[model samples]
Target: MRIPFIFIFCLLFSAGKAQEFAISNYDVLWNSQSKNSSESMPVGGGDIGLNVWVEDGDLLFYISRSGLFDENNTLLKVGRVRLRFPQNKLKEGFKQRLNLADGACHISGAQSGLQSDVRIWVDVHKAVIHIDIDHSKATNAQLFFEHWRFEDRATKKKENNQNSWKWAPQGDVKTYADEVGFENGSLYFYHQNKKQTVFDVVVKQQGLESIKDSLFNPLDGRIFGGFLYAKGFVNAGIEEGNYINTPFKAYELKTAKPSKRQQVLIALQTGQHLSPEKLKSETQKLALNSASSAKKDFKNNQRWWASFWNKSYIQIPKTADTTAYQVARNYNLYRYMLACNAYGDYPTKFNGGLFTFDPVFTDSTATFTPDFRNWGGGTHTAQNQRLVYWPMLKAGDADLMKPQFDFYQSILGNAEWRSKFYWGHNGASFTEQIENFGLPNPAEYGWKRPESYDKGMEYNAWLEYEWDTVLEFCQMILDARDYQNFDVKPYLPLIKSSLRFFDEHYQYLAKKRGSKALTADGKLVIYPGSAAETYKMTYNASSTVAALKTVLQNFLQLPNELLNADEKAQWQGMLTRIPEISYRDIDGKTTISPATVWERINNVETPQLYPVFPWKIFGLQKPGLDTAINTYKFDPDALRFRDSKGWKQDNIWAARLGLTDEAVKYTFAKLKNSERRFPAFWGPGFDWTPDHNWGGSGMIGLQEMLLQDVDDKILLFPAWPKDIDVRFKLHAPQQTVVEAEVKNGKANIINVWPESRRKDIIIK
Candidate 1:
């Protein structure tokens, strides 16, 4: 049966209208003065990012680019640019707005009755940033490059606290930077890493010097450089650092004549093993090319952002309650931040994600360089890091997931070598807090460990026995495959190896215990396991158990051609040996247990809800939904630890369990206006300002509230509040999308891809 033409047209028209409405409704507006870098607005394209702010009556923006790791493994900023007009024209009447529809920042203000308007944006097709200024009257302007780390300095011990293996501090750490100078009326700077990197030092410190050659190194010979060009400006004298005596050099450019309009361009270039001359040449070419095609590139940049916004959106109706508006506004704001680093070489960092500002603003005692953050550089905590990327599937940002997937795959050899070298195992063993070179972070591993400590375990109590979070990432890849039908053949080895490590490692532990280490029920005895840093010395930890079971089951469901018969049989046999999820009775109500047995509690995490989220073993359409609900309601730890902060899963689990009131309460808390200038720039809570994981988890919770899927069945408004009206377009499995609107207790399905998938829709 063929569909009628008018009906099809109506469906398309409604979908377009919803997208247009979402784009027009949510844009950040600021009319107050920005006191510091923390109050800055963000703008970016490709792999470049800028935090544009007006500080002390001057326009200042910090330049940051993805994959610009220095020799010490710190992610460094490119430089800072300060633009000043005659008589400080940006002091009052300042209004800066982030136009989300075009990915640009517009700043306008009047000083002494002189109107000035500035537009800042990054070229989507080129490695350049353009700042266009137009004034009502001709005026002289000056642009300067402000750099703090101008000389080679020894890293102080206080700054080394965040690095891996802080106890075994090496001799004075030397920092390096690009040589900056003025040439042909332009300021040029560049930094190139040495042939050797911190990876070699870390490997030797961990007693792996003999096998260092076998490990992967991701930082050798990396180079980054850029040139700043401003039309009609001549080179001015440089100024040494005066603030805090942090030795810095300033390159000044003064306008040759008073002009109504002036433009500045900063072109950047980065890669591995590029010569200094080549970098300079390329940067110059980029600046010239961008200057010649500015108009065309601006239009293309706008189009790119428009397409990004069109991919997916969520909008709530106007309400007198400010919280409701903030929930919808912050959702879009956080998503925009994610899009800034969409093409990064590394996955967005959980701490600050390229938008980090001065450290003194965050902690009074912690006065350090702009590169400093809570967690060490090049170290990824799997638990916190996983939250940063989980929501991309629902947001229809599948392409943005590649950097993370590639990161794990890049380090596969090192992970496998470590496992085999230590325990003669055939699978890779990824640690909880992992380094880019594929091993436990040295500082977190603890240098002064006792002889009885396990070689593969982290010395920190919070990270010990926390090896299951990688499965969540594996699950992400599997889910992405289902949502987009993308090729997973490259990732199959990674998924299988991760599961294989758990099976082999547990069996190895059982053999060490005794000849009959297997339980009477013939299940693997997972001892000395920690349930998400909370339960110490536990057996059959529920989080790890659920991850193992869920991943293995999902793996088997894939096409047989993707997995050989022998591999299939091995996984099937291993699944049965895994322990059943444990449960307990709390006040006469059955609830999920953190683990079967544990010596003591350590952290504040609620691991019992693992079965409810990340693994859909007992939620919504799954069996034992009532039992999971009882656990959520009755569990003491779950109640005590519930909050919206760094890496918290309470809001997500509540929505997954179909608890409308609980979900709304937590979602509102998660999406509330952050103290920062940008509404979505949340937290230094357990992490850093503009916490990526905090925002990422909040995004997941909101998405779950609107739509959830179990196999082929899609449930709409599962945990959404009836009083709150919403329109959203979210992705589901089998290349399907669910666009729907809910108002006045009525749900309307706008469209579903492939048409045939609509048969499985279930309104909850």
Candidate 2:
């Protein structure tokens, strides 16, 4: 796996410039085998992911796909696979590498003059896994389909965190068994959910049982699994074994005769069906069809990967401060992880996103299955989840944003039902922590609540009245229309309903307080509100004010056909009722305030500077720039809470304010190599292993530093260091793309799409 000195020399000289490197230069290479699953590399495409590694002279991997939640709402792995060569061991001359440019894994080794090479890749457009092997001499092969959920297992205290019933189960919770066996000369496995699921439990807990029939139950009768087959392999029978802390039953397959070349295919299927026999028949058909078209599928997958890499990129050469170079390399690595779920039925989770390993590696003293992640699987924390999708716009991955938007659109009815049944209002009330079925997470909703408390509100301290986070996602939908010329007409209902929640619900609360629906000056009162889980019991929280004003303005600016006269007038009226962002004098300089007034501080979050980021109301070359900058420099709370950790945006705010030194210090620190063997496998920081929000926040900061589109003007190197040479291609608003590079302290604009936009480029 080590690059030869001659090859390195030729690469640099042939390219003619260090800044003009290809994506393959950043491919991960390892010369030794992994000790455990924690050291595995991620290889996946479309919605399928595999954690691949070579351990103890054998090849191993764990399979995972999107939307595989079980009855308890736990995100489950499909199963595990193990491959072994009887005559040749992989201990000598071993090499394992991830080829980022091709979206494939290549592993090769030699033992006592016998050599072997294996290639593993997933089809980008189909739910199929391919493994191709070649050997110097004929060798016997063994394939094992290992599954831990072969029998029902009880889940005790602390283990319930993986499911929806966190810390409050109705009774004994058990992970049911999966059906696994050899069928028609293939290893088949699947998990079918029972009729009773967490969706039913949450409905009754939230007093929405009357509307149970109207809800969308994603886990009801759900079936997920696949078949592993090879032309020359036969069933070797089942065996029991223990790996790590769990016991498993593995269905084995072996080669019928020694062969120099072999091909293995696995076809996965997931859907809701009542008859297991029917589902099995469909799965077999898919496997047979995939085998017939394997050659054409391989070519199409390669073409897809080639086009994906050509869309956009960022590359930097090694520098004196190695962290700067590491930052750029890790950026591409993390983006590849996000691309794994481009076509997922659900969005890539903010916690692990399809790349989690064993739990003991993330946290000790808590032994659980591979399905265990700290946060609940189906629950979506809007604050953390928004960070995961926001960077996709500037990276030119707008097509990848569809899954997230479609998630919200599918559940729009349930969200609006919450408003109508509880408050008789006319908008969607999406909470801070929501389930995939569009209800409050039962655990966060509190099993013990006072009889007089509002039925619609969560009784928890951190999440109550924190409904404004959904506006950030609504804004993203609109930004897609502006940035990529996306057809967002389908999402207008979701946007308008979310906007109406603030307008109608606040009026309802205002009437309950006294008389008039608005204040004397005619602005909606956003009282009893929380600001990003901080600044509790606030009045007119600055985050809410900024969100409402910005989203409403953007909503009104859409194309005429997308919004009729009545819809436009209704939103314009709501815009008039949005309060102005409040300000405070912190240590003599005026800075943005968390809220007009608040009762207590609950958590650590700098919502005061939210206007500087996400909202984009104040920043470089904009009004009140000094006030926003002063908030970062002088505000005691902002200073006390500054961090480059998970879901934190201080680096983004610094970039927007044009603070080059602070941007470099924090952005580089956030994007630097992780503690794990894989450089981009960052974090259990406030989340789980391979924490995606941590990588996402880092991506936003890096993109902001390189280029920014403000007021239809493209600014280059806005917060970037001048002397550090770098190359990047990023998207801009107005359907534009910018490609630029810097070498020896001078900047060059290589190409700008729609050449007429060249006049709008400004080199900072």
Candidate 3:
């Protein structure tokens, strides 16, 4: 049958429109007062972020920047800003909407017989914040900088059992800000770390003082601050705190004239080896540069966001059941949050990620400052942290993944030095909970450890044998190499060193246990190991074995240019020494075992199904599928704790195993809107509210449900519901994109890049 070219073009255009995931007017709105900053809307670009909200008829936003670590190792906020206008103007008809496509927040309301509109956006190309205000009538306004941590306070360690206080000492923690002054109608505040940062303290405490010179200190000589400029406003002196005698500083500025339109700009700068005066001058120059190119920067910001949306999208057809819509909406919203910190020097933190509100809002009893969080600052838990980056593979967010890669590479030297100094090995020993300086987080290492405890092992039981999660991140790099075809040479060291640690560390342990450590079959025994904090003091942990085997295999597959013959041989040799995955019988069915032997279960995690996920050794169209499914069905921890929460793998494992009903059920629970105003602002489940790992794990599951790639084969609708209509564009290996649509239980392959790749499509 011959079809008209015009008809074909029109059909293609319609399909494209159907795939668009744009948010229309009033789709995301907040009309009433926000209870606290936790309910605030997130807005940012580049490395700057702001948690903006309207509280008690006043505009409030907490400003945060990446790489702004204080002396105490806390990722401190720049400061808070509060803007006040006429009270009557904000009394009625108030609404706030996040314009996803344009990457801006719009708040409008009618007050004092006048209508006002305020638009806020962060500059994509520069470290600046732009705010434009328009009103029907001339009005007066006040802008204030509310800083709570202005004075040096003695460290009063809380007795709470949280991880933040694990290694906290009783001493004065110097405030980051050295000065807060208002001059020439502009406000300036700066934070300069002391000569001694937490890096030095951690080194001395962990007995690494001998190798201190080799360590990489990211906080040393780092200075970060901002300049606030209001052209038509005059300085109104400073107030100390909200109360009469509170020790804090709040600088104020007031409008000098009545005007219907106003614009404010905040210019930020940060870097190592920078002086306070230099930072101040640089910020002033940035403010001027922002003013001169305001219009162009605004257009550029919009274009960046537009291109981001155009890269990929997942749009569900309007359904009578709102749950489906909420799931799709929350997925997009969480992705938006991840984009806010696109160029952070460090990865977007798994804890709050620059959107943390005041602590008292989450709990009244824990009345701490804004800087308080359950997890310590500058601490990255590899297991929970890997979740934050895995979804970027399918999302096709390659540019955003650079920060995370750079983080590991930047600390590679220090990590390698620590391993060599501790155990005389030639690999990087990155711990489960690591400091930014490439050592174990001080508190997680434990201050009251027994004299006989191994210095290399964390004092905590859960993190003792947790070194394999980094393999998943290495897999991400390999997957990226296939997707983007970029130079993997830079990341080769990270992959090799990560695997080297496991191989060499195990051999060191075998030596300690004598030749008997190797069973009669000659397979290395991994003892005193933990299966993801669940099975402690275990031997042959399934997750560890799978990680080593899978990563080594992938390591051997890298290009010859990236891997020398000797390196490849080393990886292949290690693979042979790794123990086979353990298995057991449950009710006459064979299933994967968590480990060969263990002392006791310390936590609730399903390491048995790990081979099904991050390792991908078992699942749909893979070997040992039945065993993986049986393990999922019978594993006690998997059955008991199969819920959508922090670090849970039930949804992901279910999807990979092609359990459609179970996958859909868990995915819905994982992606549905929480009680918070922001649909994607999820729980304090096992972490903090707006738990990033929870959202990240949910994203990974949702993407896996839609598409699962094994080598060259693509499995569509592997765990997706037939009743739900969906349109999506997801990336796969080999730089291929699978654009698909499912309508009325019929799957349609809209487009597959490099058409030859479509030959391997398996529509489930």
Candidate 4:
């Protein structure tokens, strides 16, 4: 039936209108896509700035750059500044390589020799990427940007003779030119001021070339070549004859200095030039506009992050785990960037990030684009990397979440096209590198490994299912705007496409039990390849089951009033055909799915809990959940992905399954360990650079332990330690903000906001 549109309780803030939540340590050094590689650096780099607390809000018209250089090396800054006109056209989507097109401008998506079409039409200040497109009637083409440049080597050589999207590093071309230049150690500029007005970009990184290049890769010349708006400054500026081209009285800053972070910020402020008095006066007359733009952006951004804390923040109190707060805080920061980075292009995931930041080799943490290894590509991973941000949706950090969803949506057409070309169908099957198109780069050092079974994990087959979960999760998290009817319409087709893959591939078992169906082998068989996560070569692993279950649930949960009866029935049959999970007895009582029931086993086997926690197909309140929980409890080590010494997976599993004390103790120890970086970030693993997957996952796990709203019931501290006496808030599935306090083993003072009543709020 039709799901009625109802207002979430309109929570009026006590602050009257606005609240400020300032982030420290990160220096608010606000900064500001994708592509190219031998082996794609799994998740691209753009999300770092946004999710890592690098922006004033998620969007602005400027780019932010940061870097660190040792005394021996010459590079000091990571990258630097650029500018844009409007903020609305800044669409956020992730790409495979450096996306020079309206989407991601990378070199991979071409049938090339050298290149053409995407050419440099430079003036004195900088060169403009001239990808000619039909002009927009209302305004400047939606997206645009600028960034600080410090390119070590930006080549002038053209490799092929066709249209291309990639940028190679500076070759032996030593000198800088006015049209296309590389000056100082870290700077690369594209002079295109003739189309626009007064010069407004930065010369910061260009000031830091004195550092050594031992650690910096000579070829990673995807330097800060004026950070982009994806849509470069149009035909110089705004095209003539446009109706909305009424110049809004802009300020042209004349800086009589080189550059510093503070200087760039000041220039940006002056360039926008909204006088304080004017702003104050506007606050009175244009209060709504102010509230929606600057004021609202600042307020909501703070509120958005603050709500993340209000919902189950865990501190070690006076225990050994003193660093819990910091680890949790940074973990929050990482996820936040994942939500922010895709302003108008793709969410950055790879090691060489989205904005053309330099790729370097370092011990992690401060390594600019952390984990940059040559033969292995950098450890800036994928799949598991995506799981890090999935929870952000229900956490209600919608601003950060929107770009990621947009990134996925923008690539749908390409994905479908690939599905048709590769699978002879129109399903959305993402390649191993989600952003870059085509295939594996032969240039990637580790492209071929005859000795190892894992040849760089380029198998793109399992992604359709992952994208399936993405669509399902997004439908649950999408704002009213994502859906045209205020329902899940925009995402329905994506979900249907994912389901189509299974319908064609899976066959129902001949002998079945009642309404339950099985795979032809009696085990739920996910052929082609198992769900890509868990890394170990296990066939029909639990991640696959989880994905299948989610797709089925989406179909069932789809509002009938929105879908026709026939479509609904088609989903019902598919759901029934899904099989029961296979389990092997652990010890004597508990049972767990065999790591590789049909294939080879490696890595942690216990992540089978995937179906329970992230998947939610079956859990505590469900029939066999307790057994599943016990199975995890028996050998929690089964879930450990990167355990060194003193590893204990039980703590994580406990928190995940609502076992309070055990989980807390284990989580705190990691924070307490001397192995981690000082302020908090964890590391030294293969794909190091402070794996927030562990830290962030712990935050969600702790939330579940203390106050899990199992099955949307708003249960408070359901498994909290009896002595802790804690209280917290959480954002529920239906956007319900539920709060509760538990003292002396009693969870009371419970408050629940039904859909008709709740607006955006913290559960506690």
RMSD of each: 3.2, 4.9, 4.1, 16.8
What tens digits encode model 4's per-residue C-alpha lDDT throughout 1-764? 12234422223331221122223322111112211111112111223231111121111222222221111111122222222213122222211222211111121111122111111111101111112222112222222122222123222333110001112221232112112222111112232112111000000111112321211221122222231222112223212121111112111222222211111111000002233334233323332232224323334434544443443222222232335444444443444334334342333332222222223212322222211221122111344445445445445444444444554555455455545443454456543323222122222212224454332234232222233344334443333222211345666666676566555433321122234335554444454344443334444556666666665765676566657889888877766656556677666765657444544333442456666656665554556767767666664445444342122234445655665566666655544332422222333233333444444454455556655545435555545665655444445555555555555555564444454423332233
Off by over 4 Å in 1: 1-15, 91-93, 161-168, 241-247, 516-522
Spell out the clash pairs found in candidate 3.
Answer: 89-111
Please provide, for model 1 over 328-403, each residue's C-alpha lDDT reduced to its tens digit, 9 standing for 90 to 100: 8888888888888777788888888878887777777667776677776678888888888999999977777877
Q: Which residue runs of candidate 4 sit more than 4 Å off their true CA positions?
A: 1-9, 13-263, 266-344, 348-382, 431-433, 436-487, 506-525, 531-539, 635-652, 669-680, 725-727, 742-746, 755-764
TM-score of 3: 0.94
Which prediction has the highest TM-score against the true structure?
2
The stretch of ten residues in a row with the least summed lDDT in candidate 1 is 1-10
Clashes of 3: 1
Backbone Cα, N, C clashes tallied per candidate: 4, 0, 1, 102
Ten contiguous residues minimizing lDDT sum, candidate 3: 158-167
Looking at candidate 2, what is the lDDT of residue 308? 72
CA lDDT of each prediction against the hidden true structure = 0.82, 0.88, 0.80, 0.35
Per-residue lDDT value at 66 in model 1: 81
TM-score of each: 0.94, 0.97, 0.94, 0.57
Candidate 2 vs 4: which has more TM-score: 2
